[model samples]
Target: MSQLDPYGNQTPNRAPDSWVPDPWLDQPDREPAGEWPTRNGRADEPYTGSGDLPYSEAEAQTAAYPQVQPRAEADAEPATDPVRPRRPGPGKRRATGRAGRNLPAAIGVGVTLGAVVIASLFVWRPAFLAVIVVALGVAIWEMSRAVRAVGAHPPAVPLAAGGLVTIGMAWYAGEDALMLGFLVTLLATLVWRLADGLSGFGRDAAAATLIAVYVPFLGGFAALLAEPDDGARRVIVTLAAVVLSDTGGYVAGVFFGKRPMAPTISPKKSWEGLAGSLVATAVGSAILLYLLLDVEPWWGAVFGLALSIASVLGDLAESMLKRDLGIKDMSNLLPGHGGLMDRLDSILFALPTAYLLLAVFT
Candidate 1:
């Protein structure tokens, strides 16, 4: 055997298995109190060095190349799938659909009912007048309902009295009767308010009183138009003027309109439409004058211009009311149209003006 190193390793001249004792281990007389190094060159104790401990073989392998998680399994829904079916182009009709599907059948019913009423008016004038009175009464009621819908407590008795007085004035008396009836209605409204202890009658009473005059009183002019002594012809002519004007305005505005007529109240109405309405009304009035009345062409032109302007004012008034009430339409009574109020608003003012003109001239 040859000599060896102080450690467990053999010297160059020693055999491979010949071991030597360590110098530190040979010092058995000293106390074992100090820290020692671990196999990876780190201190064995917890508070030894700043370096982190060596990882295990498994951890090192994992750190070398991380295992990526497979993508989550896709859902079975077609819309959510990665390879969804392509949508059809806008030009293509993927499914067959029914025409006239959205049209209201109620409009057809209303038209039929209106025809029956018109027929009854021609056949039996008395019965027609009575039905018209009732219709006006119902319209008054609806006006009251509208007032209430806007959170106002209208004086019901005064409103009903006003409506009745207006109807009576239309039936028996002339313009004098209308003035007297208005005076009586106003006096009665005040009296009724006092009788009710002035409890809830506030601005609502004032508004309701105004509505009574505006809706029923003005609307009663239609009855006056249907009276005898050329009243029927005048009424028909007036209606034709209003209708033709409205139609011409709507069509022209949609096609060639650029400037707004009343941007504050009715943004859709246009100056171009107003001009078209005047032109159409002039033409319609001339035709009616030649056919029905022996009036000059100038007279027809004058009437057309006046009636068109009045109709526009009436429409704007109604639009202002609706804007105040924060509503788009009065009701869904007419499909692709609006309510009776919407249709009759212009006619209401136009009829009375035409009647007065006929009374003066004809």
Candidate 2:
């Protein structure tokens, strides 16, 4: 009996079910009090460890789990796979193509503008002048920005101010009034630049004066057309002829444009395109005179030749400005057309030529 009950041969201190008792509460009298606490649903098993937070089996199990990283962050890091170097290529650009990426939008805007101008011409004529004046103001603003890129800070405010006055004078008082107003605007522009002191006065004043005269002064001719008899018809015919010329030029240039016309100024422009334009202009002028304005076809031919030559000069003038400033377009506002400056280039010269021809004929 003493051999079996020896102190060295003690049995494992466990429950009758072979569950090893917690080593913490080693007293033989104390059983696991909250070990199987399912019925009461609350285990108030006080942690006897040196921690402020009470130990919970559920919390401990949750904290013990391994954490997984998100794929988004993993992907954001530099890729591990071998990368093939990109070959040397063309310079990065926001847009490309001859016409434009947003051609539909461009066409829609152009159509809308044409509709608005025609509606204004007969219904409320002064509104047409107002629209033109506003457009000139925007052009003045764009010109200032372009010149600024080339280190000239022109006073756009005075220039815009003068443009509005010049347009208004041309509409009410005629060509003489337009000239007087333009002179006043240039004087005002020069005076306005005085406020800027001696710094860049010459360049700024000159630029402001130019902006006022070039856009608004030349544009005043179109307003003068509104003063003559059947003015709306005259303006419409002029617009139609110019538009036809531009269209013909574009069509010819695209298909049969092998040789450049003035490669130094505009590489895309071709002599073939100019020839097409002259043909279209001649036809359009005859129709405008005989059917629309009741003028002789011979006179129309003369007008076509003069206006076509002027139109080429007009386009080249704008291109020269762009080339000098080292810019491709004045603005990206007109989508496929470029900017207001680009659209008005041909029309600016055409309007003046038409006015001069009309004065001679009358």
Number of the top TM-score candidate: 2
Q: Considering summed lDDT, which 10 consecutive residues are worst modelled in model 1?
A: 94-103
Q: What lDDT tens digits, residue by residue, belong to model 1 across residues 1-362?
A: 55546554545666766555455455335234364435465434333233444344435667899666555524333365477888878965333212122235434644664575567556766665666566666556666666665677666667676777766787677666766676677667667666667666676677667677776678677677677666556666887788778878877887888999899899889999999999999888987866777777778877877788889888999899888877766775655445667767787789778877766656
Give candidate 2 misplaced runs (Cα > 4 Å): 1-101
Candidate 2 clashing pairs, residues 3+ apart or interchain: none
Off by over 4 Å in 1: 1-117
Supply every candidate's count of residue pairs whose N, Cα or C atoms clash at under 3 angstroms.
Answer: 0, 0
Clashing pairs in 1: none
Q: Can you write out model 2's per-residue Cα lDDT over 1-362, one digit (the tens) per residue?
A: 12212234546553456545444444344337757344346555545443334436656766899866688876697768878987657743334335444556667777988898899898998788877887888788788888887788877777888788889999999978999999988887788778879899988877787687679988888899877768888788778778878877888888888889999998889999998888888888887877777889988877777788888888999999899999988898876667888878888889999998977865
